[model samples]
Target chain A: MAELNRLWEKRRTDNFQMQLRYWNLIGKNSGLMFVLYAMIIIGGFYYKRWLDGLPEHFPGLLLISVVLSALSVRAPVRTFIQKADQVFLLPVEPELGGYFRSSRIYSFLVQSFVILVAWIVCMPLFFQMAGRNPVAYFLVLAAAFIVKGWNIDCRWQEQSIDDLIPLKILRGAISFLFLYSVTARLFIAVPAACLLIMLLSGAFLFHRQAARGLLKWDRVLDMENKQAMKFLRFANLFTDVPQLKHRIRARKLISSWFPVRSFDREHVYDQIFVKTFLRADDYFGIFARLTIIGMLVSYFIGNGFYTVFIVAATVYLTGLQLLALWKHPLPQALAGMYPVSFGLKRRSFVRLLFALLVIQTVALSAAGAAGMKSPAGFFAFLAAGLVAGGLFSLGYTARRIAKENR
Target chain B: MDPVLSVEHLTGGYSRQRPVLHDVTFDMNPGELVGLVGLNGAGKSTTIKHILGLLDPFEGEIRVAGRTIRQDRLGYRQKLAYVPELPELYEQMTLEEHLQLTAMAYHIDRTTFKERSGRLLKLFRMEKKRHWFPSHFSKGMRQKVMIMCAFLVRPDLYIVDEPFVGLDPIGIQSLLDLMEEMKKQGAAILMSTHILSTAEQYCDKFIILHDGQIAVQGTLEMIKQKFGDSRASLHDIYLAVARGETKWLN
Candidate 1:
């Protein structure tokens, strides 16, 4: 039992460390952060001006209350129970009450941030529309905390029951109504609705506890796994998470472009590489998305030099990311046993990267030429892209691989 | 004729400073099946890694079909097919795609690849799952995919590690039959497994490893005579060897 508590603590610590690492990486990307902060600041200035000159019949209170209530209604409790807990911890189930209670408290504290952020975002509008009363604002905050706590309890109970959709909708509706009443300062309706909600939630909790003493271990573990995977997926965007397994779909329509065919021994890896890049979501999806974004940015920029630069940068990033695919076969023993030379793997990767870059360059140059309405611009962009692709695929990538190997 | 695989005084691991396998040496003859048995952390996998050229040998050398990885890297590797302890597969590749890739890598002719893959898939009862990705497979199914891929190559040597762990009984039977068929066609195999009963039944010889060294290596009769216990089962012999109880024989 003590070990279980330690496990929970460790899970939290590890999650914190992972989040910290990624957050630091994100913070270090100064250009991206600068753009994000600029957008936020610019957006915020216009938003405040818009709020200051708002229409009188905006139903601001109703809108704010409903959104806040909806946000507050989803308070998931992270139990941190893993798949192995079913086998190892099932025998000690009765002694797990304290552990679950602690988990619930931890969940409430972690999830409180959502409620806090929602309230803060709504604060300016509330002051502008509802006439700036700190007492009323504090009351709303207290009421939101109470409602969020109730929702957490209800959701935990809901996990044990089958066919909970109707109950969930009912709870959501009631929460919206209660929040509306409180926010609107309907004194009589507020006390009455609060008491009714409390009574209803208490009864529901009692009924649920009596109906089932056993926690749904499978559901709890599944939810924990999903939550962990969500964190891992987020982390994976910045760096490779070896434990993370990306979901794969056949995407037959996309894969049809690269038909698999028998190749001689020298190009066997080339055939596999092409097939893998076309079929795998990680490689192909990234390539497509980056290429599309590059085209869009190039089209919008209109200046030939800027478009060329954007295309070059996009191609470089795409090539860098695709390097991971080169190491993919390393993890698979059977793939490693392929009689192909290490140099062949590098050649195949460079060939794929060069081909993809060429396609991107051609598309971006065409888009850039159309935007700028200059044949000379198209030729210039095309030359720049080809040079960038050649330099990156042939020189930079090969050097990177060599340095790593050495 | 030269043995298909020969590891002479091979010592290696992931790191150069600390060698996990110390002076490990063994050989597998053509048309032979040798079971490499060991407890966990006893260097069964390390030895396999050395043969597969994933790790550089810290000392000595390994040769496949009389060619060292240095002398003829591609030729050395092309002669062997490996199935690892865990089924390491591309999550994105379907069963059919895995087969296609393996066939291409081994340079199997199109008709031969089609014929071999079809027979292997049906033998493992995985024909219905030809389009299923690794994500959709159970452990047994994934193991079967590895088995199918290895069998598709029909190489001169097969290096299998703990293949029986996740396989169904029928899958195991199919694998055994395929190995036997390959052996009869003059292919050699080095299989690492803890399942003493299956190894005893199928293997022509055994290499019992302890603390990274070959503790004992021979036919059942020869091993029993060396241990001065003519009636000992392979399981008994393995347990005794793992616990260092056969010091007298050593």
Candidate 2:
């Protein structure tokens, strides 16, 4: 037991150190803090405005119930099992209760802190929607803690069972109903007895299926790897994370968006860049998200200056993120062995970046122009975006990639 | 006839101050199969890297098809194909797309690419799973993809590092048959491996590297004659040479 405790603590310490290092790097270099601060300020201002203009039927109870239940049911246990642990700890499987119990306690505290903060943020809206004091805030909070504990216990038990998606759906529905019955202080007085019955039955079914003897070590280790990978993926957007390997998804729904059909010598780099952007990982996700958010802010700002700023910022950020495409390991490994010339690779890559940046520029410029006060400002914004995007991809990005080999 | 590859006093590694390969000189003629056999850290992969132009020799010259890499960079690389020890692939690419990409990289025309890719896929028995991504592949399947891609190019020379690992018996036989076919077509092969019996059976000559140096190299008849034994197997020769090498170092 002491050996297991020591191992768990060591792993926890290592994980904390890794997180602290990346967080420090992210703070020092990425300038992400400034972006986050600006978004928060903007969000707060809009949130207050929306609250002031709130109508009678906002469905606040439904919103609170949905958000809380979703958060609770999606509880992830942070087991710090390495790949080697399966080999090293298999003989001692029956003795890992203390280790897992510690993991449960640690996860619960962290999640509770997160839930508490979310509740604090939503308090104003809760009061506003309730139309008065109604129920004590701590009473709702204590109920939240109990529900979180129940979820954490059941989720731990459920790890041993296969076909978890249907069970998860059932758990999500029960969680929502349970929170709903407990939090509706005035209008609907559903019996607390009914909610307790639902919780106990769900827990009982999950526990019985999980059968106590065998722990799915591979699944637990896989979960741990996934949690670590999520953090590493986020960190990679800021700096190069060599440990990060991008995953593949076919994205059949959006396969039509890839315009490359010819596999000629000229389209070698083009095919690689485009396929990776569309299918490999987060490059396309980040591009689409930024474009949508930029357009949304532009549409609402209605100020020519801010709209122009939004257009430039969106294009710039997308360009910066897309630069990581060149640094990917596939291109680097191919760079040496391929009979392709350095000049041809550079030209093809720059061409693709130009096309991508142009698409974003046009999309953003159109949205910005529509939000502008005058017709003349529309054309001006459009022209500016075109020139800026053109110079960026052709001149700046071209020079950067060409310098990479040197 | 001109040799397909010539390494003249090649000495280099990842760094200059402490080299991993020292004064390694060898020549590979057309329609030849040479095996590179060594223990770990014997600089087999580094030698392959230099030949592939991934690393430059610090103080010597390497010429492929009569031209140095610096003199004709693209031409020198165009005549060579490389299969790494462990496969490196684009995760999103299907097996067929990989062949297509290789064709583009090597400048094979579409008609020729389709013909060669069809034949190679049939050879490796991978035609059914042409649309499968690498994520779904086993180690043996991934190695087959690497082999198929290399053979599809039909370059003048092939550099294959440790090709026998993780391959099924059929995969191994297919690879050997492919090598034989390529040799018949006048393509030279430099294969690095530790599978001694297979190497002894297939390779026309052998280069035995020990601690970054070529300890012994020759055809089997020449090596056996040098050791004053008319019937010394490659295993006996390798063991004798390795022991002699250790004694000399001491």
Best by DockQ: 1
Question: What is the iRMSD in Å for candidate 1?
Answer: 1.8
- What stretches of model 2 exceed 4 Å from their correct place? A13-70, A114-147, A163-213, A225-249, A252-263, A279-282, A289-321, A331-333, A373-379, A399-406, B15-17, B245-250
TM-score of each: 0.83, 0.82
- Give the distance in Å from residue B92's predicted Cα in candidate 2 to where it truly belongs: 4.4
Cα displacement (angstroms), candidate 1, residue B57, comes to: 5.9
Every model's Cα RMSD, please? 4.3, 4.8
lDDT of 1 at A351: 83
lDDT of 2 by residue, B1-250 (tens): 9999999999999989999999999999999999999888889999998888878899789999999999988899889888888988788778888888888888888789889889888877899999899999998899888888889889999999999999988899989999999999999999999899999999999999988988878798887777777887989888877776344222
Native contacts, share recovered per candidate? 0.71, 0.57
Give TM-score values for chain A, per-prediction: 0.83, 0.72
Docking class of 1: medium
Candidate 2 chain A worst ten-residue window by lDDT: A186-195
**iRMS values for every prediction:** 1.8, 2.0
Q: DockQ score of candidate 1?
A: 0.53
Consecutive 10-residue window with the lowest summed lDDT within model 1 chain B = B241-250
